[model samples]
Every structure is written in structure tokens, then in C-alpha cells.
Target: MIPLGGAAGRVAGLVLAAGAGRRYGGPKAPVFLGPALRVLRDGGCDPIIAVLGAGARRTRAVVDLAGVQVVDNPGWAEGMASSLRLGLSTAARLPEVSAVCVHLVDMPGVSALAVARLLAQAHASCLTRACYDGEPGHPVVLGRDHWAEIIETTRGDQGARAYLRRHAGHVTAVECGDVAGGYDIDER
Candidate 1:
């Protein structure tokens, strides 16, 4: 367990890495897991949790997940929602986690700076997302208060888009264009 935060807040990094990466020809988790973990760790997120499915076994064999909590999602083939649900559930179980900064395994361009920017704004009810040039992107910070609703609303590959859209008035968009690119790797 991570040390509880004093006044700022404690945020956990949840990496959605269960996809089989059909477009990229294989699981990107094995190739990019380390970078994802590094981004989260360097950004100040504690008690990180990585959810794996498709290549869970291979990813475990190739990736060094020391000090990081790993969760295996058996329903990954259904879509990214499964991974998000599993990751969120795991985060909710961590008593010290006030918020979760979600990162994608295939998004190599997302840097620690972006994650830090988002995490800096974390609060018990804050809903923040990293946006590049006004474009909403990864490393979305969902406070613990909203975990249950997000888990209930997210479906398929939509992730938390639907919830964010519905609550745009409450969501904070942190500009990270200077620190990271929002593009995700979809092909070789």
C-alpha cells in the first residue's frame, strides 16, 4: 500500500493494457508496459495498477512489473471497457487512492509531464483529463468519488468518453500540448 497523502491527494496510475492490438499485429503491452509504468511513476502516481488480458502471460514474462500491482482481465476481447472496469475496481480497493490517472499502453507519446499536470489537479471529486492542443486525450484523472458511476457507464471501447461528455461542465481539461503528444499507436 502507498503512503496516504497529507493534503494534496494520492492518485494511482491505472494502465489499460489488455487489448490484443489486432491492428498493431500483437499485444502492445509486452512492448510498451515499461514505458507506461515509468510515465506513471515519474509523474508522481503511487500504487500503480496495470490491467492485462490478451497477452497477460507473455506480458508478464517480458515486462518487469516489480512494485506495481497487476490485474488480469479475462474479458479483454469484449473491449477496452473491460480493462477500464477491472482497473477501476482495483483502484477502488486501494484505501489510499483518492484518484486514478488512467494511461494507455499503446500511447507512447504520452509523457510524465502530461501525467504530472493532470495529477496536480487531482481531488476527491475532480474529473480531469490531459488535452493536447485542446484535444482531449489519455491520462484522464478520475477521482474516487466518480469511480462507481464511470464503471457503470463505460462500455465497449468507449472507455470514459461518454461520462466525460455528459459532465463536460464539471470536467477540467489540463493542457499538456507542450509536454506530450496525444496520438496513440494503432499500427506497425
Candidate 2:
């Protein structure tokens, strides 16, 4: 497992933009969400690495966020696991990152403060997740120490579900009084 605070001792944001978006018919990463770039970026987090796959270039083309790095995941077509792995691996390498808060492009409404709160709560209680009002949601925060544990069970688009399912006991349900936690554009 990646030891807590073993890296640069700060959090790095991982924006999962590598999906093929078969239903959306194009790259969803470049899809604009208000004034912010399609790739999620927020306070207290280091640079965001927009993991790209399928239409890597096309999705990244429209993102105008400065200092945002784009990393291609060859395994993206294989599934979401590859993108997760690629993102986590990149987070592991950053000199200033000790944790990763995963944000999905489709869920653009999740606040940066919500993510920070989860991380803070986890560090205090040794928790791994802050479920959004009893239901799990995006922007799952993982301490550096949990990296190795997650990397082992992760393989594809399962995203963080595998890790969350196995460690359900470590999850803390949180109520943020916000709809972003419950909102998902793709949900029908």
C-alpha cells in the first residue's frame, strides 16, 4: 500500500476523462461544464491529469485549463480500470501528491470543498470514503497509503467500486446538502 503522506504530501486531482462516451457520440472530456474546463479542478489540489483514451486528442483539444496535463491511457478502450490505473500511477509519481481525489467529467457539479472535507474526515477517522448521503458517488478520495491496496483489485471501468465494496466498513456516509453528490447526467 502507498504509505500515507509518502509522496509530495499534498493531494492531486485525477479527472477521469478517458472514457469513449459511446452514448455521447464523442469525447466527453472536452464537453464544457459552465466556466470550468471539462476536466475537474478545484481548491487544495495539485494539477489535474486528464486521462485520455479513445478520442484522446479530440477530448483534450477543447480544454483550455492552463497547467492541466493530459495523459493517454492505451488501456482506456479496455475499460475504466485502465484509466484508473493510469491516473493513480500518475498521481503516485507526482512529487507533490500524497493522495488523489478522483473526479468524473460527467459529474461536473461535485464541489472541491466536498472533496477536501472527505479527505480531512478520512485522515481523522482512518476512513476511505465519504458516501454521498448513504449512496456512493464520484470524487472518491483515497489516501496515498491505500493506493497499493486499490491497484491490486482494480483492472477496468469498475472505477473505485471494487475498492469501496471490499472496504465498505471504511466508508463514512456524509450529507453535504448538495445535489451534486446525487446528480449524474448519465443516470436514467
Prediction RMSDs, each to the true structure: 2.5, 4.9
The TM-score between candidate 1 and the true structure equals: 0.95
lDDT of 1 at 51: 95
In lDDT terms, how accurate is model 2?
A: 0.64
Can you tell me which runs of candidate 1 are displaced by over 4 Å? 1-7
Expressed as tens digits, the lDDT of each residue in 76-153 for candidate 2 is: 887887888888888878756667767777775676556656555443123344456666676677767777767777
TM-score of each: 0.95, 0.81
Local distance difference test values of all predictions, in order? 0.89, 0.64
- 22-114 in candidate 1: lDDT tens per residue? 999999999999999999998889989999999899999989999999999989998998899999999888888889999999999998878
Q: How many pairs of residues collide in each model? A: 0, 4
Q: How many backbone overlaps does candidate 1 show? A: 0
Quote the lDDT for 129 in model 1: 93
Judge candidate 1 at residue 123 and give its lDDT. 81
